[model samples]
Target chain A: MRLRCLALILFSLSSSLARTQPDIANPHSEDTNWLNQYAHGLGEQHTELGLEALQLGDYAKAERSLLDAIQVIKVNQGLYATDQLRPLQYLIEAQLTLGEWHAAETQIEYFQWINVRNYRNSIFTYLNGTEALSGLLLASSANVNNPYSVRHLVAAKNLNWQAVNAIEQTFGSNSLELAPWLYRIVLNHYYQSTMLRRQGLSNYSFKSDSSEIVSGWTMRHNETLEMSYRIGKELLGRIQELFAYHVADHEQISNDATALMTIYQGDWELLFGNDEEALEHYRSAYQDLLQMGRSEAQVDRFFDRPVSLPAPRLQMQWPDQLAAESNEPLQFFAWSPMYPSASRPAEPRGDALAADDQQTALARFDLTPAAEDEPADTILADTNLSLDNLQILGTTPDNELTREQARVYISLLQFRPRLVSGMPVKLENIELEYLFPPQMSLLPLLDP
Target chain B: MIRSVGAYLKIRGTEMFKAIFALLSILLLHACVGSPAQSNAPRLPTDAEVEQYNASVPADEHIVCRDEIPVGTNIPRRKCRYVRDIQQTSTFHREQLRRALQ
Candidate 1:
């Protein structure tokens, strides 16, 4: 009894909704007898008639037959049935050629609505929205009537949003099916920007770094954020495309935490680790100072997992890499691990037999700076090494430090430059910064 | 037994009539509401029509326009404006980051 009442109430509400929703005036001329003839013909006959009229250049007659054919198909095959999509496709081409942007947008939305409905009901899941999105919103006029009754749908208003939402709702959000929609969404926002219209925006064009051809853009709003996001999506697409087929290659290309070259699918952060990762050198310096002299109370001051890399804008707008091509010998301030001299080379006590691929992989990311040519003059004492410290650990029977107590860390380094000095200076004090950590140097540290 | 069978047949017939009427009404309403029309939509292009057009092309690589395309086929507008060309500007991105950190 309760279920019956609920169904009755729901039906009444829907009927009321139908009554209250104003029937948008038919934009096409309704007084014509040819369109009225659509009510009498079968769907197949109408389709045949529409095609014939289309070929004869009688578009008014063609549109009548085609629209009726589509409506009939919607009722028979279900609103979003794969077969119901054909007539709508034909209809949109007509609208596009006629320069009816709003109508084109509306027709596409109807297609999206049906596809979304079908997709929700366990029909084919991945409905491609990109192609429909590409040619939309070209009509200078936003004025148009919604012929198909889409709920809460104003013609050309949020049509891109609706399409994107429907596709996302159908396929999971991360699907590459989203790539073109995001691209289109950003473009639509530019089209709608009030600032661009006031400025008489025309032919703002540029070539993407990856694509060879130039594309024109008009700013609907005055902001580079949309542009940044579009590139971000492109990078994301590239990462997914590469990672699917080549994980090993991607990892090597990414080069672990700080990739000079990044194809981060999600955002700029993936290229570099979170902001804290960018400031790792500073944190390490603080920790090292605590170990040397500072109190334990300061240790808890800095640590976070979900962090952002400070160089987001940097990744978004890269530097002049042509500098690397230049002959300028830039300056640096270096304070890091030094490889030992041959005689002073640290004891190699690790089991030689245990060498394996895992060790080789581990060795790859180790933060060791390669020794420069001037290592001979730069011979320096190991600051941490002490005669008493060595005595505490003692030595093996052969006067050698055991690998357990005395670790001959190859090169645990942190390179920092003297910020005041322009160039030619070596590292002085540690600060918050990110540097492409150098690989292990050939030359080793020697005791003074 | 005969009366019940007749009643069931009557209910099924009524449902069929309603479905047909509803479909026809929707078609009538939808047919009157179209917003645009093309003057000259070609018939579905044959392979020969497409092939003949392609043979007269001048460049090794050229963008095909809408007029040259068939009505039945979908070719999205060639005008693309996706900004932030990473390939052209990423070198700048790498350089700026390096300089900022340095």
Candidate 2:
């Protein structure tokens, strides 16, 4: 009985030991070890080295290191199911700095995919808002309408509303979390306002006869000021966080923080209504540009070029004047009555009269009526006579009358003169009497 | 003493069998676990597998030629012989001739 009891105890002990010692062929062990090593290597001041490379303007090296870190994190996550999102964030920043927009977009998409795949549902709420803001800004800069831009704005608005709901549900109306929610609310309003402005619907009614409409429209203009203040406060908080940890150099981080502040301030002042403040910030940015040894032309091309506004006066006047100048000369003569044969011979007789008597008679004539008819003769005489002859004949009434009548007739002929080649006699006072041809009525065979 | 020795042998044999059974059971449990859990596990492709995969994939999808040839080089012309009969063939042929002359 004693031996059997001992054997039973021993067997139980042996089975427990066997269960505790997992199978040697287990695949998870090797993967876990690899993931640990990869995470350790990547976490060991990789960001510091990458930032240093960036400071030295070794962009290629920085990009390579950052990408390497991102790849390591990706592989590590695949093996161990651990979150390594910081490396991806750094990678995105590096890609942005390098102006690799496509790569940045791809990385952002990957980050979003990872978040969804890992069921980090709350992460999208924050990242979606941030990415949407960034996309909207980028789209505005490029002056392009794209799916990314529209989706981003929509996502941002939705996420912000979700965040608001979350905060309201969790903390109620009086919560300190409302502070961050306010920034998001402000952003949502600003984005809507700007979108409205872009679509030429700036005057739209958000509500009937409410100040909210005006406030909504003005929010885009006011956002720069609000954003500058917000960014400044955020920078201070970030600086305090950085200093509290002593993880990075305070001066360098402060400079970068302040640089971003200046960038936002400059952007606001320039885009909104603070040109003087913007100019100061721009000058400061320009100094940094100079320190970085960037060319003036490049800086100008990137940020400082003047926006082209619609020159209303030029837009209104230039085309009309150009059209007038480009056009065929006015066929004013085409509408005038044809000259009578009696009037043609009268013109030469009037030209033979003396100049002194014509001036005395012109002074007695009514000035306004005479002036109205003056252009009639002047146009005819100007068209036919040498400029010098026209000048001399202009002072004589008889000569002027004959010239005026001739001009009126010439103008009529030039506009739509009857082709009188078929009839040898010179017709006088030719006009369009009716729609149907007079000649067809006189001779019916002429219709064909 | 002989009985005691026999009992010890029997216990030892049973323990070995138990160890083998435990290992097999654990393996079977692992196999019962779905593909998604194992999908996270690392897989090192065998040389033969890799070679087969490479062979199965179209070459042009993976290979990109970016080297610039010197003017009047025959290498580009030689490459033209392998080009597929597509719309780009005539244009490629003309470019090859132009490059060869240049």
Candidate 3:
């Protein structure tokens, strides 16, 4: 029995030694190149699997796969590797969709840390990272279930401001590169203004702290609105100045960019309820475009539709992107409860909108022109929408409440009136297809 | 007026000494007042520079740069401060308020 015990002990020792081979510190025992290649392959495989699972609505599986992918990438490339950002983003998306807010927040923090490190290394990489992070933050802010949606929106706006500062620093204050960033801030201002309107007056006295509830002085509602308006106007003006400089530097390339910016300025004014100023800007822009060699018909056709204020994307030029006139009903998708003006994310979060689950309301309204003698600042009073009929064309799990909710949302929208020959023209029988946000399909909608 | 030459010289010397004393007093006063305390701190950065520095640092260290109108001034000037400093200042004020209330 003693001989048997000695033999067993020897066997156990040998097994343990074999198991510790990797940690034995043999300089030539391992192939680092092979290990790195293997890790990269593994990370890529896991990432693809995670993305596929995300697409299939298997968020839990996606989260698992993406976490594994991030671990693999970190092990090979070391922490703060730019390679891990993609997987981190996917993981964040999965966590957000699964309503795992804390997990999502932690991942977002990690992603931001890695992004900032990259910023020090390469500016272009930093800008790309900012864009990705901004999109994620905006999406998070738009999530109806997110309790800290306002904080996310504010953070996103601050991020944009930082990006603007970086771009201005790197590419000069008057660089054309600053236009998009400035435009984004202006859009942020619009969203913030809307949020203020939604929240009312009670929450105005205190500011939100990251960890603890801290009471701090804040701008009153009207003051905050005024500030947003001023900031937005200033930013839009800066964008115009940048484009004007670009036009001058580029040998006056048609002045299309300047003209487009002017129209946007008008849209900004209209959004803030400065009707006379808005009209003046629109008319000036129309004439400017005409002076730039664009035919009257082309300019008129371009401004024919009643575009929603704070356009989803900034249009720097005209005619090149003029959509072909179509008989299809003009489609509008609700981006978020907080940000009515924001465009939908390129890759929408959560389950893809299935045909069976689609809720669409068809409405016909006469978009009236701004009255020539109307008061200049009729703030948010929708005098232009002459709703002839609002019919619920189609809805899944149809209910009266859904129809009513769609009607209310559609009514709240502010549209830039169609301009013809430098004059606002009334548009009649404009058929609009309003698509409700997917998350709000079955739930009762609240006034945004 | 045309007394002795030595006495004349003495008078001239006294006047000259008084003039020198006055000049030195002016110089001493100027030196004592100084040139408005020349700060050894580096020149404050422009809006863009602040942003560049902000981008390099972590979020807590990031600076908030904006145009601020000074009291009794119509013109707005760009002001930048670290977010951490702002938070600390705010917290300090809040604590003060709480203490006062208590």
Clashes of each: 34, 5, 0
| Sort order, DockQ high to low | 3, 1, 2
DockQ of each: 0.01, 0.00, 0.08
What is the docking quality class of candidate 2? incorrect
Supply candidate 2's per-residue lDDT for A306.
18
lDDT of 2 by residue, A149-219 (tens): 43344344433444444555555644434334333433333344444434433222222112232221222
DockQ of 1: 0.01
Prediction 2 TM-score vs. true: 0.26
Best by DockQ: 3
List candidate 1 stretches off by more than 4 Å. Answer: A1-45, A48-58, A74-82, A99-109, A122-126, A133-174, A180-221, A224-448, B1-102
Best by TM-score: 3
Candidate 3 Cα errors over 4 Å, as ranges: A1-38, A201-206, A212-216, A251-254, A340-351, A369-398, B1-102
Q: Write down the lDDT that model 3 would get.
A: 0.73
Error of 1 at A106 (Å): 6.0
Return the interface RMSD of model 3.
Answer: 5.4
lDDT of model 2 at residue B89?
Answer: 60
